[model samples]
Target: MGKRGGSSTKGWAQEPIGALRVGTVGPIADFDPDSTPGFDGDRRLGEELLTERGEVLAGLQELLFANGRAGDHRSVLLVLQGMDTAGKGGIVRHVGGLLDPQGLSVKGFGKPSPEELSHDFLWRIRKALPPAGRIGIFDRSHYEDVLPVRVHSLVPQSEWEARYDIINRFEHELVDTGTTIVKCALVVSKDEQKTRLAERLDRPDKYWKYNPGDLDERAYWDDYREAYQAIFDRCDSDASPWYMIPANRKWFSRLAICELLIDALSGLDLHWPAAEFDVDAEKKRLAALPD
Candidate 1:
């Protein structure tokens, strides 16, 4: 695809996660929902750009998969957290669809089941981790424990507050075991969210996706904002830093996430594995087989 306004590949890969990260200081209030951050392209062109980059994206995923198949025990986990209608599903459908399905795992976490609630919050998360040879995407993740739980008072403040340290340690353990975690928060403005929710209500095809409770949650927008600030303050870390993606524009959001994934994979030395057996001998053996 033709270049957009974003940083160069060389620069992006080397840039610290803090460049687009939110931590300690809460920038949500002052941050622009429509900010494109190194990208100036509009939705119309951004869609075409994503199409253009598809091949390269697939190729990079293949290299990562090949590395895993060749016995490299590393894998990638993309954790997507955002407000409702912020396009988590779109990321899975667009950006994630570029990868080989055989090597892709997507887990959508909803309300905890009775069984899930019985264990630690991370219990279900651990079960959803991708194997060494695949890419895993979480539609919503463990951060839900901190966000909605904290906002709705599902857990006491002391307990949810304590989860920050527990979560950091859990992520550290995951990294120590060869998982690279990429966390993204798709940020949309209150107005933008209202527009999206309205669209869902107005369209017959989208009616099934609408939930009355979304309105209830919207009432607590400020509360959730504060909860998110808390998450950024305590959870953003070197091992798994969070990228705040301005998602007012769906096309740009998808493109930005695609570029982010490409950059993350580029850091790894990925290559096609050399054949273990003699290629000529293997070819001859196959050639001699009966049709």
Candidate 2:
């Protein structure tokens, strides 16, 4: 799991991915969703995953720095899409703390602005796209156009269904550029969400995190589940696959996010660029002149 889960010496990849099942919580799985390193009630290598994640994150920093200096066009689009109380902001904050802010940008989307609604769904999203040699993160994204828009009948069923193909082609185009997309759906159980909401109510500082209408939305959890299943089924691809991150454990979710990012970043040919001028020789000449 070192530097992006690039090498799984512990055979983590050989084990199944558990904790969150596809078609129920997050994405479309080719094999059984019940399989993973944490399956059968065994949670081995949790700390090890954290260790690997940290290493990978360090490597990403190094790689990003090198890319910036080398002027290589590389981009990472981290789309964190999830329901309320899923720790999307928390995860983004934790991971973002690790990176150089000059090269990073994070945008959280809410109800459309008058300007945002002026264009189609992807139009507002396109404005936030990370340029080359930088990382851009979206806390909530265009996927909302599919989720809530379809969930509450904000749009026609036919209209929302048509977005699958549109979104796929859009992502395809993103890959056609140099952008690598990390699509993570953070998930917390209903009970956990309720507990978090209670904690928020009790703590004055945490009050900002809660929304009263969330109670109403919580009733439609089953509908959102179906919506996610459909989205995962239609959109998971080699160009941009989905990661069903378990948000029940914040540490693990952050670790997995870093692991996946590291995995993808390590794939590029990242090398320290050759010195433009002979700095060593220049230093020697200056020293000699001073003497």
Candidate 3:
């Protein structure tokens, strides 16, 4: 919703310029996966910009962590959802790597365990939430209940259908309790996915990243697309809107996500907590101590 650009000469902008909030843009199908929406730079420039912003990102994260330690009740949750090979891991590594690990919580949700399935969908999600002043990341999240389950017919129609409202309410509750949610759907082109998948198979080093079952899921690509569209339609709200990230270019996606994190952290307007002890008294006490 703001101006699209690489970076500001001053500092990180309060609103990310790279990607638009879901509703402000047209249907997901119309957007180009390869296009860099708000960026005018090439890959080299994107990389440099990301490097430049890393310092700011780290400082902001420290402010957040400090506030939490000082008893602030605010935090941020970044939810990343996308097709296989859409670069979720890359975002976590490149962007998440920039911040202090102590201030960040990353959780990847695979197929639910039996124990997880026994509880309400949000139960596990609730447990994984970032504590006050930390950033929590969901590699895949509650939307999985609605997306994969709906696409594969893993649950009854009515049961999965109801989760849309359930998720909306859950997010609303999170916001009311001082959590800022940043939900990003990383969209990659099918052709690019095929290329990436093939590369994984061709490289012995990357074999561990591949699964035969990924091919099975690829057959249902269209169905999954429909499911994701439903998610954007239903769960997107003012309190926690979705950001559709075009992830065909891994470098661009990584940079855009970094910008989004900057926007989220800077928007909080956090300040360094004041020292509880009297500074002058503490200084005098330190001065009086034998070196």
Candidate 4:
């Protein structure tokens, strides 16, 4: 793995998350989607670690929500971008399951509605941003404007090409406004995606998960790869760096995301909000009214 910015090993014991950060310039094609980076543990250990970290994660999340109630502007935004069946849903279900839903906002961005198309590309995105003291998760994000739009030629070459700088400026503004952005590009092997898609067809319970259009997208795998590589090259920044997550192994991807969330929250250095009323006075009043 190549690293360009600062190390992400702060507050971690096992391995540095910095290993997963994309370098200044590289081919996304070189990263192995099946390999677990910055982690030495297997599935069993991953599950155990995830369980052990839940308490800390839960506490930090509560502190974040509490701070929000106390008028803090700090928040965290997790952006997940990947191919279909790259386990973005799994990250939401398992990793996000650790925190209180009251403080977590998960949004899935699909094809735009007619109304959305009438406005600028980021019009809908700005509406979904997580507020203060919340951990917002974007299933797919503004990067779609550059990725799919560029690959499919949905817009003119000059228009989509200009979005790179536009996105960078937009993200810088988010960071400036006390939002810590953790952008993750989940990398899944083409073969693994095929198998996962086939499994969805094999099981009746997964029928709804299958999309006929997924095959259409798969045909443009190489094109999408080039697009993603372009994103890594252009959109990566120090204030809001992109983490390339290996998603072939569902367990590892879930575990890695959980750790990343922990790191993000921990960096905030939050604490329980102080009570506005006097503690002793409140206690005395409660005692007098006890049944």
Candidate 5:
């Protein structure tokens, strides 16, 4: 059998995360998801990407840990968006797995529940914000406030249209408070999506995910595309911008994300706090504890 696909080579190691920028996608050929090829049921193309992802993730952890020690804490809010089968959950599962669970939190936003709907769009989101020194991830994120709800006419065009400014201010506040916001939208082709849908249908365990409703949604592809374009156009600010990730190949997507996130966090002024206890007092305290 052909080797399971993801590359583990150092050549494919993550680029400096700072190298990525919104409105600056260097080459569709270079970063397109189709470049990644999977083997069997696995997106084996993530092999090298996963390795790089792991390293960068470790780097993020180190920074957070140092911040924790120094009491000069920083927080990160990572937002993920993509069409269905774009690997949002998988990225969370694998990329997030590298983090200390205590320091990482994940939230997946679906349609607004009654309670969530009752409140303003950003209300439910604020509740999930990470405290200082931790990482918080939003799987579908508040961007949907501007995208699907607007595209599908799920809400008033006037209400959803106003959210761009609201989102920009909300994220700017996070950045102002020493929180870094990393946002990405995973992109995939209709053909690739169909293949994945076939896999879901063929597998018994995945049957629950087979939504005929998705076909109806697929008909609105152009609307979703326009919505995403508007999302990037308006909400892509200096404080927080959207990174459009090609997701045909899961490998490139993972590495791209790892690089972007790690880059954002690499050089923050992180450190361990100086210890204040007197040596003798600490020694005595330890001595008194359990002889």
Candidate 6:
């Protein structure tokens, strides 16, 4: 919607040059998974920045929550889509961990259960939406319908192919009804994924985190890549744009996500809700009470 480059906006963080933002159609291969846009600092600097921004984000989130409770009736939705072990969990813990749990809703979409599969693809997503005045995080979101469903041919070509329009319309409806959607694709290189997966087996403490099935899916990396390319092509929009974040560096990935969210929430123009009750009268009443 705005200029496609590395520059600061009045209320939002500056996107770095080469950051892949889907608007019309473009090749995903142009974006390097190792590139850290807008952040040229090392991991140590990334950590410091994340900490500083985390505090600011917490305050903004509080304002958003207060405004919602005071009947503003708007919310923020962070839709995270990525291949397995792409640092989605780390982003959730590091960035989302800053917010008050009362105003946070985190949902992970895995393989649809029998009950979920029976309904429309977006049924669970719609149900899991963050209420007005809160932030919602989707560990993996409705995009799965387009990605794996197409990659694995779980649905007919005609069916999954048509989902792009469905998703676009669905996001537009959400925007109309007062939800701001920020979708991020954590881009981790295949080599990095292999390293992480191997470390999982090498360390006993990380055994539970290791999934044998992930290896099976690794075989379909190219398929998943193509699937993601299609998603960026079809679903990226001004209302709900997709951001491809280079996640090979976990610290940088976390910082970028926080920056994205901070930028989104900052644009909400949130304010602390005014007190509905008479402050002076309440103060007088309390002062007159016996201690």
Q: Which predicted model would earn the best lDDT?
A: 3
Model 6: which ten-residue window has the lowest total lDDT?
A: 1-10
What's every prediction's RMSD, in angstroms? 3.6, 3.9, 3.4, 4.3, 6.3, 4.0
- Computed on alpha carbons, the lDDT of every model, listed in order, comes to 0.81, 0.72, 0.86, 0.85, 0.73, 0.83
Q: What TM-score would every model get versus the actual structure?
A: 0.90, 0.84, 0.94, 0.93, 0.84, 0.92
Q: Candidate 4 — number of clashing residue pairs? A: 0
Q: How do the candidates rank by lDDT, highest first?
A: 3, 4, 6, 1, 5, 2
User: Model 6 has how many clashing residue pairs?
Assistant: 0
Q: Whose TM-score is higher: candidate 5's or candidate 6's? A: 6
Question: Candidate 6: which stretches are off by over 4 Å?
Answer: 1-20, 23-26
**Colliding residue pairs in candidate 2:** 3-56, 4-262, 4-263, 16-35, 16-36, 17-36
lDDT of residue 62 for candidate 4: 83
Q: Write the per-residue lDDT of candidate 3 for residues 1-291, one digit (tens) a residue.
A: 112222454332334443467775568888789977767778988788888888777788888899899999999999999999999998899899998999999999999999999999999999999999899999999999998899988999999999999999999999999998999999999999999999999999999999999889899998988998899889887779898889999888887788888778777888889998899999999999999
Across 1-291, the per-residue lDDT of candidate 1 in tens digits comes to 222223334323333244467752247776677876655456776777687666667777777788788998888899999999989999999998888898899999999999999999999999999999688999999999999999998988899989999999999998899888889998889999999999999999999989999989999999988888777777788778788888898887787787777666766657777887899999999999999
* Clashes within 3 Å, all models in order: 0, 6, 0, 0, 7, 0
What residue runs in model 2 are displaced by over 4 Å at the alpha carbon?
1-52, 278-291
Residue 223's lDDT in candidate 1? 91
Ranking by TM-score: 3, 4, 6, 1, 5, 2
lDDT score, candidate 1, position 115: 100
**lDDT computed for candidate 1:** 0.81
**How far does residue 75 in candidate 4 sit from its true spot (Å)?**
1.1
Q: Ten consecutive residues with minimal summed lDDT in candidate 1? A: 2-11
